[model samples]
Target: MQSKSGTQKIIMHIDMDAFFASVEKALNPVLQNKAVIVIGAQTRSVVACPSYEARALGVHTAMPVYQAKGIAPNATFIHGNFGKYRTFSEAFFEILYNYSELIEPRSLDEAYIDVSHLVTSMKAAHALAKEIQNTIQKQLHLSVSIGIASNKVCAKVASDLRKPGGITIVHPGQEKCFLSELPVEYLPGIGKRTKEILNQLNIFHIEQIANMPEKLLIEAFGRTGSAIRAFASGEDFRNVEKPEESKSVSRSKTLEEDTLNTHLIHAEVFRLLEECSLQLRQEKRNCDTVAVTVRFSDFYTISKQKKLNFTSNIEKELWPTTTTLLQKAMHIHKPIRMLGVTLENLYKTSQISLFDYPFSKVKNIQQAIDKIRKYFGFEAIQTGRTFQKV
Candidate 1:
């Protein structure tokens, strides 16, 4: 589609088909065409990804494993291996990098690539999309669905319309027509609550949203209403942004069993803190904010954050704040199901200051420990605070 600047903008959104399950199938030929469901490490973990075969039987991502089992009794359930999936993801992006530099990664399994400068016509864009799909399939042994359109929003919508190696294209000047008959939920940023509200207004399709008065929508959704209407009318002007450095690092884990034991919960939080700190140090970054999140057995989640006086990647420097945030977040007094730690406001680590001299020795010791872990393993050394029995 031609932009206001009179230049054609061709954006392609590529989404991997059941990425985790597909990777597992690629690793084992026997899993091909089988109903596979990948779950998390925890006993009460939910489905991380379900293959099309399992999905056909009503199994879906985020559904509890037990419920998925009830729906697809014959499905093969496997614990997801993030490390292996990351390896494949790196290869996937490497191939995309060869096609265009203007790529925005939505997740490990999906990305939007701006190919405006490469393809001159709709035919050329279609050919390029197919080429990318074939390249990924041939190299990674995994299928991908692609969507080509003038903007990111429409492209994302088009990509989901097809699955398992399908390409859907919305040519320039056809964005509104392409979205009209689709459900309102097809538009980005329209969540379950918003869909319910729209349904209450008898607005079921994109065409209804596109035709609704801006004033009434504004009265209902406030300032965001106008943006929703614009998207519904296929008037998105957002560009495919280039990838940026991570602004935060976080680690979370679901417990083997829900517990009210404060000590055990503290131990899990500390373990997550250590993991986040280690990651920060490895990235040569430091965070000025520490946050803790607690999830109760009833699925109620709360988070608390505190800003530090100085940026630090050391576990010792950040632990005090992390603990404080955890205590504040756990005020609900319910059985905790998961614990998470987040280190935010990240920046490249600077040279230590004179004011930090008191912790310089500690930093050296921590660096030495990091070196040991690098050569040996993370479990080779454990702090006393992180050791506890459930």
Candidate 2:
């Protein structure tokens, strides 16, 4: 379809079919064609992903494992292995990189690719989509659903229409007609609450939303209403953005059990800080802002941040700021359920201060520590502060 500039744009959205479960089935032959549900290791973990078979039986992602077990009693429940899934995800993107450099990863399993430069017509786009599907199926033994449209919004909605190895295409100038008959929920950003409000207004289909008065929609949803109305009409001007470098680094952990012990909480926060610092140094980035987050047992979360005059990736240099932020954030005398450390306002690392020899020495020590941890594991070396138990 031609954009407003009179240039043809073809956007493709690819979503894997039950990604985590599909990966499990691909790796273990025994899981093929059987109902599979992937869950986390925590005792109170929920289903991470459920196969189509399990979904047919009413199981879904984020449903409690116990509830899923009751619904799909005979399904095979497996603990999720993120490392294995990441390896497959890397391979998935590697294949997409060969098709187009203008790719935006929505998640580990889904991405948006702009193939406007490669294909000349809708037929060519269909052929390219089929080729991509075949390549992924042949290489990964997994299925994907693709939606091809003039823009990202319609493409994402179309991709979900026919799932599990299906390709749906919306020809140029047919975006509104293609989406008109679909439910209002098919439009992006329409969640349960929004659907309830829409239902109250007797708006069940995308066509109703498209025909609504702009002032009424704005009144109903504030500024977001305009965007929702545009999406319902299959109008989205957003481009497929290339992946950008991370602006911040963070590490968080849910404690085994909530506790009021300040020592243990401090230790956990320090451990997370260590991880974030290590990641920053590895990326050759420095952050001038440090933030701490604490989640109470009641699920009440609070965060505090402090900005420093200088940026550094060394844990020792960042710890004082992190500690002060943590102390400020943990003022509520409640048992802590989780701890997180964040480093922000990042920039490429610059030359170290020549006059600050003490800071230079500490940086050298941290680099040595990073190399040792890279060869050995992170647990091979631990500071006294991180040695405490929860």
Candidate 3:
């Protein structure tokens, strides 16, 4: 398909297929082709990702492990290793940087590459994608799906059209035809509710919306109507962008049962705070502000925050501050259904010292313990607090 002006905007979207689960498989080669699910070791944790084999049985990310197990009973579940995943992601991006500076990494496993400047020929783009895919599979043992198109939106959609170890190339002038054939829901950002609303208006496929009357569409959808109409027609003008460093890290969980028990509430709060701090450390970030949120059984929610004098990601230091906020926001008589902890006001350098306090010796010992765990693995040592659970 030739463009009207005979020039194409070459863009490619590459996404690792089932990234977390695939990483687990890569580390443990014996798990290849086996149904796998990545979850937290904690029984209450949610499934983060499911391999395609497990997905076939209706298992999916964000599902509770209990629910996922009910569906894919024979599937093997492994706790996620975020450290290893991040290392692999960084290496992948380092390789991407060699190809083009106009690359946008959407996540640890998804990125958009504007290769128009680098590879003028479609054949070269296809060949380059093959080489990149092979490199990842060989170096990382991870398969990826790549889509090439004239714009970012179509390229992203085309990438997902083909699953695990596949590529779809939509040459210029064919995007409209290619996109029109897809369901409106297939376009990004159209969620279940939006689909229902569009269906009510007899707008089932993208083709229908592309040709829909602009005035009537605007009256129905407000400000979003023009964007949606243009999107359906493959008129996306969004550019690939290099993402900024994360400014905050947080963790939250919903309890299966609304509980008024103080012990259980505190346990959940500590769990969230520990998880959030671990995430911040993984990103090499430290927080000076700690915030907590509590939602009651009736859905009323309250949040409180405290700013510390120094930045910290140490659980021992952060938990007390978070728990104090939790204590104030929660009423023991009310059954709380959800809890969240956020660490903000991130510090880029290890500029703050924990040794300034009068209790510096104790803090030093804790830091030593954390460093040991960081290198030797968490299972190498356990505190009396964790030992009680065992």
Candidate 4:
């Protein structure tokens, strides 16, 4: 079968298992085969990822640590270093791009590759997967699971059936049989609520939806239901694409409850600044602008931004700038429901200088802070702003 451009295609989904925990294990071999969970400093913090050993103990991504502790009391926990994860992720994608031009990064841990023109057979595709996995293991010391198929849906599902370092291939002619027996929940976009509705209709298997009458499915799920049916039948026509240059880097959170406290709002802005600054550094880009978005209890929204003289990825510098933008946008009209901080006007920088700071003293102090944060963990070194937030 040909894509809209009349090009035959083979698609592959590559996924890293419990990426954060796995990377920690790779860096410290002693952590291997031990239950591990990556989290932030807050007990209310969510689990970023859990190793397979932790998963067996009922630990899962996004579970609060207190719950995770109950599930895996003996598990080791690590506050993840996003800088390290992003570095490895970027290098991993570079290797993939060497083999195919059409690559889609779904997240920091998984991506899809369209290698139709590069390879001609299922056997060849399997060989390429092995080579990719081997290269990653050798170069990055991480394991990746790969699934090869004719389309995105099948490849995505196949990638998840088996955990780390496994490969599954779905031949073009066998897509239907390969996907039919799986549960409806296996299809993306069908969340817990939708699955309940489908289960009520006795349509638990993907094949049930594939064969459902279009009119009834549409009546039950609207246009989305029709799309899901097509997906179940292996009809995804989307093409794999490279990760787009980010238009903006942002951070936001749904508050536990609405509040009008300006101090709390300021604290939230600083936290966001820390995350955005790190993201900019990881992407090797600097921002010349800062923007703030706010949502109010009455659902009113407003935004404001400031153009900067130059971009820097130091949180201490960026936080103050971002705080000014947020203050301008906040009028205290209603309790705030959410807060957002963003960086834009991104440009790559290649030069590194130890003399950028005014006088040698400032530069030396900055270097000391960087070293402390790197070796002792980011939380080990914090600015006054972070303490005030606490």
Candidate 5:
């Protein structure tokens, strides 16, 4: 079916079936037909993915391994290898390009393709979807679910309707009807908190959301109300866009052993902040917001951040903020399993003021240090904090 854009677009969403768990099963034949879960349950890691068999037993993503055991006691839990998954994803995209080159990768396990130019009729699109789905299942031994619709929102929702290996198609005129019976929570951006708010308004179904008075919705949800209303009406005008440059730089480390040692945690934080700072400089970007995240041994995670008065890519200037954020995040004195730092609110190097730094000597030193690390390796340089081990 044609969109309101009048045959200008046909969006298709492809989602891999139990991506991580399936990858493990594909590599190890003995894992086939078993209720397999990828990601170690012993540490702070959560269940990355569960096979269809495991899902039937109520195991799900983000469920802690400790808890998932209660549901699938016999399921095989594995520590997933991402390098292999990336190799599989690279091959997966190569196959997708054979169908349509206008592909937008949503993640390593999913992508969207604009097939308007390749197929005029819905019948042709369905035929091609089945063709690509079968090709992946046969070639890589992986199954994918596909959703075809007039717009991306509808296509994305359709794709998730069926799991493992199923395909669903929504005609242009049927978008509103198809969504009408779905819960408000099914809308793309609506979360648990948003659902609670919508419920207070006596709204539960997508149809109710579509029919809400525009002025009332705007009053209740501010600008967000208008956007979701358009989405409920299946009027998403977004094109399948290409990936752009990263807006933030970040680095994280999961400790080999979960520890309560403050000194060790502090050192790792400095290392992450240093690594993240180097990335910002490499990209020739400056950031005004610095954030620190701490994942506790029990898997409770907390993040704290603050805006700096001036943008910077230098670790020396960034450290105080990272330290303060780490302090705030660790106020509970919880045993830490991971430490992370992120630089955001980025600005281009060209846009920075020449006199942004009161002392130009610091900037000159930082540039030289980055060059040494780039040429002689990170070990060639040592920040005093990094030299210590608790």
Candidate 6:
């Protein structure tokens, strides 16, 4: 039974409670009610996720594993498994898909959903959220927190209002009231530098941010200031974009040690690019922007991107531009600790001119490679360059 009411946006932000750690518990009943922390690939890597039990002991995600150990000394540390999590994520999103297809996944465990058409009243929305939350809890043995609001920002903020299996709703026109008391940092897009600027002005709350003179804020912060003011007023016009509706596909790795070896650095960059390009091909997408990044030992990172005249996912087609960007990124005095390859400005693949002989040959080669990989596995075909010694 739907109650027809005022026409306004209704968005829900659903976040799984301690997604990775929760999945660990779901897999092993013996681990329940105990502090658990998931570690990333490298032994020295940071905490990928911490269970509520671990969080209660002051362990947090992204805290160094060493520091987290100090905080939760008796916590069980499990190595994170992306494949297992991906399976759970698929099931999790499938449940959400049962409710609506207008879903935007923010990460592996969180997403935004627009239910404006299905439920016309706040009460109905809350009921639906509870149903969804309960379904996940009963079926998957996982806790979820949800926020119901008129827009994504408020909903995201509200979703955080309560923890593990809680719901907070901000009725239409109550966005300001709901956000007034929260710290200015709670607003999306308000990062460290912005917080510093706002703090300098003694602007620490949403109310203070909302009350700041528009012109003065604009003069002080430029174009971003206006956005800050609007966000403070709880104004968000962003829509819930479908998960595949994206501008880029990127992958990066932090190396185990800092090195300046050309062979080692270039090899890592190409491997990352190979992964990014494979994703592009799988999506049947092509890109105009090819970029490379290098993070030095000191953590000072730099990137350079090349905009091509045409779009492509063909590795050979992207090779030259990517090499140029990599060269531009690696010309630093500091040893490189991290590298990334990103493809941007993506769209569905389109026909290429037949006269482009090299692209045609390479494209044919890649298509053949993709077919073989599809039937066998990605490991069945390998680029000779990927085997180059460091």
**lDDT tens digits, residues 170-202, model 3?**
877788899997998988878888899899998
Candidate 2: residue 311 lDDT (0-100): 80
For all predicted structures, in order, the TM-scores are 0.77, 0.78, 0.79, 0.80, 0.68, 0.70
- Which candidate, 3 or 5, would have the higher lDDT against the true structure? 5
Which residue window of length 10 is worst by lDDT in model 3?
Answer: 381-390
User: Candidates ranked by TM-score, best first?
Assistant: 4, 3, 2, 1, 6, 5
Output the better candidate (2/4) by lDDT.
2
- Report the alpha-carbon TM-score of model 6 versus the true structure: 0.70
In order, candidate lDDTs are: 0.89, 0.88, 0.81, 0.82, 0.85, 0.85
Candidate 2 segments whose C-alpha is farther than 4 A from its true place: 1-5, 81-87, 260-289, 298-334, 349-390
lDDT of 4 by residue, 1-390 (tens): 456667667899999988999889987999999998998644347898899999988999889988999888899989877656766777788898888888898988899999888787889999999999999999888999999998999999999998878999998888889989999999878899999999999888999989998888899888887889899888887788767898788888656578887877787778778778767765777777888999998888889988877666666666667877787778667898888888887877454322355645754665687556544445566666656645
lDDT for model 4: 0.82
Report the C-alpha displacement of residue 255, candidate 5, in angstroms: 2.4
Best-fitting candidate, scored by TM-score: 4
> Which ten contiguous residues of candidate 6 have the minimum total lDDT?
350-359
- Candidates in descending lDDT order: 1, 2, 5, 6, 4, 3
Cα displacement (Å) at residue 268, model 6:
7.1
Give candidate 3's TM-score.
0.79
Q: What TM-score does model 4 achieve against the real structure?
A: 0.80
Q: Which has the higher TM-score value, candidate number 4 or candidate number 5? A: 4
What is the per-residue lDDT of model 2 for residues 217-327, given as tens digits with 9 covering 90 to 100?
A: 999999998998898888998999997989899888888788898888889899889888887877788888899999999999999988888888888878888888889
- lDDT value, residue 173 of candidate 6: 85
